[model samples]
Target: MPYENPAALRITSPGLCRDATFSSKHALHLLSWNIAGWSAKQKNLDLIAHLNKSDIIFVQEMWSTQNLTLDGFSITCLPATPSLPKSKGRPKGGLALLISTSTSARIKSLSSCNNIAMGVLLSYNTISFLLINVYIPPYSSRVLTDQAWEDLDRYITDLEAQSPRALLIIMGDFNARIGPNNDALFASNLWGGEVIDHYSSIYGRISKDSRINYGGICLTRLIGSRNLIMLNGLNQVDPCAEYTYISGQGSSVIDYALISQHLLKTILKFTVGNRQDSDHLPLTLSICLPERGRLTFAHNQMANPLHYTHKRTFWSPLVASNVALFLTSPSGLAIKEKITNATNPFSVLTDYDTLISKLKMSLMLPSPSHRAINRTGLPRWFDKDCLDVKRQLRQTYLHYRLQNANTLPPEYFIIKKKYKSMIVTKKRQAVHEGWKALIHASRTKNSKSFWELVSGSMRPSNLAPCHISSHT
Candidate 1:
């Protein structure tokens, strides 16, 4: 590996992305539900409002998300035309991810299939989350249903490959019952029987819809191939299976939250919650991340973690594939022309510098002249509220652990929401304060004073405690 952090290596290479314990961690609370337009009901509005506060929310079966707006969230919705015939209130289809704007979490490079799936790359300060929200309709024809799953798998696989180091989170209503603990047990009608009140992390779980269908088979295959660990039936698992969908017809744990197996340690709790005016319930996943890094937004899929050095000439990655692609790019072709037309060595050197600048811009990076700060140390903006929320969040986790509970209490979320809200406010306030200080210094016309300020900001935090390095 070129770097000490293994997660810096793309996930396509086995074991490379697995050991990223050094990467920053945060307590990420994700809620996945097939809302089915429950928010239209006045009584359910409060529940939906609370759900909207989650760090990351995946909403499926949207009847009217075309005009759907959630406060303090950035929405990425995959709209469906609702061609499927419906008789009742409204046709339901589509998927959405409401990522909280209250935090530094930023998402970009969204790709989606019409009402089927939506994929995005959500980045915190250091770690990236490749989030995919999917909804597979229960088509009358088994073939059609199977095909939907297939298309979704392809989309998910492609997205994962594109953002190899991102922690993958796939959730939403699958509408497929993947049997029980033993694939044979579903067929034989023995789900470890009554002996298995709540089996932990078992695949093909026994639910109201006990029968295994072909679509379910496809879903299980996708799960296995993707190296995902399903959180639906895991620690402290629900005794009743907490089926996500229910109706006169049946109830099943169709909605789920699946994370890459390597993220197992990060997962604190996965619990199910019910909301009024909707057939499908919500699945809440609490991940204990130790770090709350700054947020980043990307224009395209991120190539890799940025390497900070003084040299600006490393604009184009020297890898064979990158070199080949860059050489054929329009900018690369133009650079070649400049080289051929150069009248003298100095002019050639000037064009070479321009070439480097253009290449960095193409990669969505600042030119050599641009200075960017690396904030790996504790932030200066952290205030009392930030500390209090952090304390409460930790306390809540401690209480949950002491009780050996299967799910997080409501207080955890209450603290989580407050922490997110406070961070946004403090960061904005700090930026304004910083600029004011800078402006005052510059207006004084004291180069010494200005340089001193610059040097102070550039200096690394001497207070940073020593820790074991990945390198020997």
Candidate 2:
């Protein structure tokens, strides 16, 4: 059992830790949901059965007319073409990458024309992860313009100049709204929340100007070139006023996840999942590493056998005996018998004003806007215990996506060995069906030719009518 290197290999130790629990050698699990426009019938199959416990999924308004396939995932679309519409509304979809089926998650497509962004690389066992899924396009000031935030900062500076040393995890729905009115000189001030949601309506003064405008830019070049680590920031997601978007009221917190500061101290748990059919609410982060095995070297005696016998360490004690049975059981033995019968280690600051007047009911910790306004009074420190060894590496990504979807080879066998003569040229399929019927008659809504329903399962219906010989 030793021949690995297909590439998603990081097997813990690039910071973003995991393993708070579960670990068939830390699999992979990344599920970003914003499947709003795919319309919520049965809340979009219970959000794809909680994104079938994820391996990689980043969907956003994915309604490119729907050629569906979310169970056992593997779809990659980023539509909004026909010259990228949106002068009226209903036409801002793009960003779909749903990989799972046993790791090796790959979905390139970057040089953004309107921004749906992608970059995943899960690979199992030997380990690997490079995740980058964005869907930035909101907060308009004209067509939510400024060349749509410089085409989302040149598709996040060309996906951090193509995975600059991997281990990323960018996450999505960046409708852009960082905290404290977003710093960095008003993090692209999202056009002051689209001019406060367009003068608080009156038919939002007949909207349009690219839909009541706004702006957002300071991702500080992927948070200073992948230094990341912000995790569920904008008021720690859903702190409850639950409004991905509503009309008769207003809401904000534009989803996010950053993380990269070497996995921000192994980020044990960073929560936010209460997705009510998408305005955006599903941001789970749980990382824990430092736990492999095998190490025994005590014979250095000034090594000289051509120097290279062994020297690796640092990976034992991942919760030493469950932290010694939670500090010796019985509720840590009644808080270590009241801190050893109160004999100072700063004895709770001498009964801290009689233990805050007998503990002001469980020492208070609920305020993320009062648990976003009382979400079942959330507490116990947001009920943590989250882990994701790539979500126990989803049975090694459903046995490598059904052995590469049934013995691989057929995702259009190299696009029919390079567009099999522009698809058997009959005047280039009648000028590609007359420019796809004039981009489906300047949409507004009705898009669904997602590369002709997933390019006929990667094509090969007796191709060879090859044309294209205009070598003049």
Candidate 3:
């Protein structure tokens, strides 16, 4: 049974007090991950890195934690209900969605079934869409009960009844193993009035290694009935590496992102994350929107000319080298002769704004080409040693893979264990250092630095304020 408590769901608005407007240019990048019960003690730097690249994030298995606040994204989370005895020991079956602050997408409504599933109705401009995040627990019987299917069927039916035209995106850890192998069985049971064997043969069989769990059958029936398409089917970029969950037992593609049939063409890419922060890997979906615009940032803006001028000492040698090369070129020689032979020095001088401009022109370094100040600064704890350690870890992993084709050597495991320990140590040190800096700023009452630290810690949301309500 799903959680029945209405208070289990909480709507959070991070920074914005108004709604944001989105268009075609603002492509939506969605990331889904099962964090296995995220806690404050876990290092979120890698997770934050992924969040920075995404417009919206859907997370599952998020247990109750004190640090619910994430910088720039408004979070809506639904905890497991106490009413469900199944949620006893595994209180981590919570679901949450994080929407970028800058997006114009506004939450129109929210709905949840405790730890089973959560839904958010979002609107951009006049276009509305339903985003559902779900987590179906693994059944010991390897079969989905009739009630499970009924619950899903009713929830989706209600959504369709509420807004028939709204686009639908259903994503998260379904704990379902879906592929071509079980198409015949799924189609025969749920897809009636059609030639089951013919449809199954057309879909073809998935890789032999991919298993078909009972939940997968339920998902197939749901999508087939609704004319929905799974994003996994569109993943032609890398077919073999489609699994989303891996453990000591092995790997299986259980996580998914499904969309309405009409929105299939909008999908640009679907792939899984290589980094492992949890047992389940993250899945990403990039979709082109109907509107168009570049994603701009304050840090990406061009630096002031004065700032460059003050740092001339650093670039002087490189500039001189470039100028020397230019002087020997045909175009540079022609300009030099023209300047020397010109009747009026003032006229030649007028053609060039300043010495820096002339030098820049000669160096072929336009303002746009010059490197800008890094607006997105690194975390306070991220130091050179940490970076070096990460590089070494990658190198070691690469070497191990190259040496041991398909086999895992005992030595390889030892190397991996050693590096993992070193990484954990470094991460702890960095977090400690970051907290120390924050404490110092607060104690000193340095408002600017303190707020900057706060803002930097969590990217501020750029979206307008909107309300969220969860229907149990």
Candidate 4:
């Protein structure tokens, strides 16, 4: 059965999932990777570790693998539509999105064209955006015809037309190489001249080795028409200058993340991962989102006998007075006569639904407090002294970086070493103090205090310890 509620569709981690709330101060980390049919059993742990850092992830070519679940993520997979034509002996293409459990983002599935593409409307607080993940099949004279390209272009155009105000973010393996020189805004030093020429020669040049092939031309035109910014092209220097995809034919940059112009200022960083787990490396982006106010309600204590008694006592007198007033009213004469003349217990009883409605209308329950308790138990070592030291450390590091550019001064490293040592010493001291207090409490036979100390000393787990056996 289809879920009627959007929240009902969500699956939470079994244990130790953080209470996710929207915050404007922090940046949202997004990652996209073409895993090239992630089927290696041995690399599962490595892949999970890499994905843990990002809040949202888009993976392409996730072929043939089911039951691929992570500890702190909700996974949604879309496999290639069988109706689409496939090449003989070619592996089926698939895509997946892994959203962090510790995110306040609400996601609703949007209409998409089969498995070639998937779209989702994401809302975080007041901000809403449309994210489309697409995997354009490699151009082939025999297998992928012009019809495929036409379908993809049409889909994109329709998506834009539907949500004109939405901040659009299109990320995937486009199978299109957009050379640095094609967009004059990109500096020459960003990409090597030889690399551009090599791709141009292989793919056929459109305009002097700067733009290549029909795919590249289509993508460039799309970017221009949409007023979108190519994150890779905006790079001043290529952090990962090596090609994204490597094969017998050689390397090329086929993966891309094109976002709306409004998001350019919010971009904190962009980089391509150097991990060799797949032929294509991961592309990571960090962007700051608008801040939102956190709302939390105090835990309801109505289940407790003492709490129930207190509530009953507080409302009983008021309820009795209201009931008496109702009985004396002119309209209440019919009800009063009916109650007085009732023979059976059932005759005297009011309808359960109507009784509840009346009680709710007459009775006023206390509102739950909005103030949230601080659950993060910082160690005693994290005191004002430690805070002062941290401030000094930050200032020193910033000063050194500003003066020396990318190079760290020798004094900065010396101070960093000293800072690390100080933290270690303070932490050890705090541990010793905690142990001493625990021992004293135990010796004194203060059971409540001992238990409190023990519970307080324990650290909160961030990930579920056990693995989920079922995927669906």
Candidate 5:
């Protein structure tokens, strides 16, 4: 159970992951992460900044008693009611939801369940969604607790009872080890009503674990009855069903994203953060709303979360000596052309960070290039076969680790090496074809396809709003 460093887990531009592409403008992004303890420290702040691309963020275990604040977001924090006799210290069992203010999103009702779950109705863009964040207490599968089983059912009932019905988006750390999607695991009459397929429609989802716990059993049955799909392993995009929490005790995918089948189309890809500043990883679901989706934006250019973004400077050693010297010098760090922090080029300015941003754009805008590069997260050439292999590799790897054997079974290496080699060969052929297409496009003066492929390969698509100018 080796813990992967959060830094090594950071997802960067292009290349590997199939779901690392897409824009936030045409899509709604929901990110769920357990921060353990929320604070104002630099690492937490940096983590928050990195996650700013998400439109809706659900956080669990806030562990804070005071109200929390974040720019560009409307935050709601819910802390479990403590015992009457011991209510004087640090608050425990906290949950939070952060919605981007840019959306015409309004919170209608705030409610909770079994002191372990809470939800709010979100109305925006003419669509209504009941958003629930849950943090279930640990309970043994052998001795399932009544509270753990009934909390969600009761909460959903109360929230759905609101005047108009809304779609459901429930997510959080359930501490449930639902190994995989097995029809046998669920009782035939789990919910009294027969649900066709029992599993909601999901393109690619796979779970690696085979260990089903008390919470997992309850959750599986509950979602089965309600027609909600658990968006994690047991599928393709995240085939290995990456473990959310890892430790000496071993790892499992305890945290999850539960959503109604209706919201499936808009989601180009579903991803789980490989690392974060917590024991659990982050899960992000990107939903592409229609282009005409009613999103509120300030007339002020700066107020738009879209239309602009900050890209880190990529230092280059190939540039001319004089040009490189100036770029590396104290003066280059200043947007107002005044040298202040040569030690830190990323220092924020007080036009509340806007004035300096404009000045920097004016000073360092890139050379002109083609436009029309829409990042849709789907790789045009990556077909279903490639996806299947990735799914298998991940599942196998997880199984190997969990076995905890000193030596792999016979023929394991031979099979592993064969699969790896096949993937490498396929990757090389794909890259060659891509470059060939790029060259042909350039030769034929077909700029649209050329830039699309180029930009797609160069950087991962950001959820932040961005626009390319006519000048560049």
Candidate 6:
């Protein structure tokens, strides 16, 4: 009646619905938000609204916040470390994990570092999970930059070592861009890219850096090798293409959710929530995990027909029926491209020439491959040469992300324009009709067909492998 505990509440709105899709498989909606220090009242109200929109929330930058509670809901907060000897006071922020009390996940072990790194080993029925909250220091520099990633990497490795057989969900303000680190330890520094490139570059160097080199043990390298989900934002539909830092000259995603391999197929949709509050926009994902146990989504012999059915049909846009039918599919890259581009402020005057330039530059490679560095006379301890390569790769990706973010035409502004010639919002009526069809399918048991429909919307190109965990 009175909103259970405002600090902890369970939302039962249709919008906040959850169900076990398969006998053992269930759907979990995980939401991450940087609330930007909302007032306790505002935080409570917002938590209600957010819970209405999501199943669980990972909140950050909630300093001086009021106690939160809600009916049928449970919350675990990693409070700011108390009384530090100046040198070790850590940061002032913390993270909170809110879950439905109706659900079975209970914290088995919980701990938080001063910088807001919290881990909770949770058990739901027979399934187990390790959920971690981390907020690495942003504003890149040489020493601190590498240290942050190393810390995160070590933390994850430690978790993995502890629970080798559990599902993992690591989320928060990573502060580090998926893009670059600025140090010269990386190849990008040798070639010239952003400081963030240093992360990859330094790790590369560490692999080969003869001194203090872990030799292929760097966190960035580990992320790539492990098959963890990186949630790419460069391409369309990676909702993160939009700028999260509203006021910065530079904008690329620093917030993310890295899930383990076991949950990859279960990822229903990864979306960026457009809420105004923190410098970082909220990231939302809907995952369909096994309710009872794992069930194969595809038959062993069905094979991937599309992998062999490769024809370059991406040039032609979707037909009216297809558009109507495919709009709701989670894999509709083109639909996202069309809708976001049409409604975005960046798409207006999107100079094709400029896009081409950015794309090319974004794809450029640094000299001396990671493999090459292993052979070169470069010091092995630091693998500084490999760092160079990492820097180059990150810079290339960052370049594209920045370009894409800038080209995004503001949605509100686009609707206001009355151009002399009709600006085709990609045949809006056709798309709307398609959306209707998608909605209908979603209501039935045929929603699985959505992927098949949307899969045809994008052309197949070899993008870099996403940072998913390599081993289960």
- C-alpha RMSD values across all candidates: 20.2, 26.7, 16.0, 19.6, 20.4, 26.3
Error of 5 at 231 (Å): 1.2
List lDDT for all candidates, in order: 0.60, 0.43, 0.58, 0.56, 0.59, 0.48
| Model 3: residues with Cα > 4 Å off, grouped in runs | 1-24, 40-43, 65-67, 81-90, 142-145, 179-209, 233-238, 292-472
Off by over 4 Å in 6: 1-25, 38-47, 65-71, 81-91, 180-187, 190-219, 234-240, 248-250, 293-472
The residue-level lDDT of candidate 3 at 290 comes to 51
Say which prediction, candidate 1 or candidate 3, comes out ahead on lDDT. 1
Against the true structure, what is each candidate's TM-score? 0.53, 0.25, 0.57, 0.50, 0.55, 0.48
lDDT of 6 by residue, 131-218 (tens): 8877665534556656766666677778778888888888887654423321322332222343432233111100111111222123
Residues 76-153 of candidate 4: C-alpha lDDT, one tens digit per residue = 567643323543243467787666644546555566666677776666555666777878777665236355656666
Candidate 3 lDDT over residue span 1-472, tens digit each: 0211122112121111122333334577889988876653134455566666887788887765222445445567776443346433434577777765445455544666635777777665546678888888786763344466668778878877887888899989888766444433454343435443322212222432345656766776676677565656332422433557655456577888778755655555676665545667788887666542322212112122111121123356777888888777776676676767778654365333223234544553322211111222333344555456555544654554455333334553454455557667866886676678789989999887777666655532223345687862
lDDT of 3 at 46: 56
Best of the two (1, 5) by TM-score: 5
lDDT of 5 at 114: 54
Which residue pairs in model 1 clash with each other?
25-289, 25-290, 25-291, 26-289, 179-204, 180-204
Kindly list the per-residue Cα lDDT of model 1 for residues 1-472, writing each as its tens digit. 1111233222232211223443324467788888776333313334545675588888887765353445445666665454555433345686777766544554674678656898878776667889889888877886687678778888887887788899888898887676544444333332223332232223333333456655565666676666576666542333345567654455466787788866765655677764423667678877655344432322223222121113233444544456567879897998889888988774575466556544543453322211222231234576556666777776765676567554446776666667767878987887787677778889988787677666655523212335887995
Best by TM-score, which number? 3
Q: Which residue segments of model 4 deviate by more than 4 Å?
A: 1-24, 41-43, 65-68, 81-90, 142-146, 183-211, 237-242, 293-472
CA deviation > 4 Å runs, candidate 5: 1-25, 40-43, 80-84, 88-90, 140-144, 183-205, 296-472
lDDT of 2 at 172: 77
Number of the top lDDT candidate? 1
Give the distance in Å from residue 120's predicted Cα in candidate 3 to where it truly belongs: 0.7
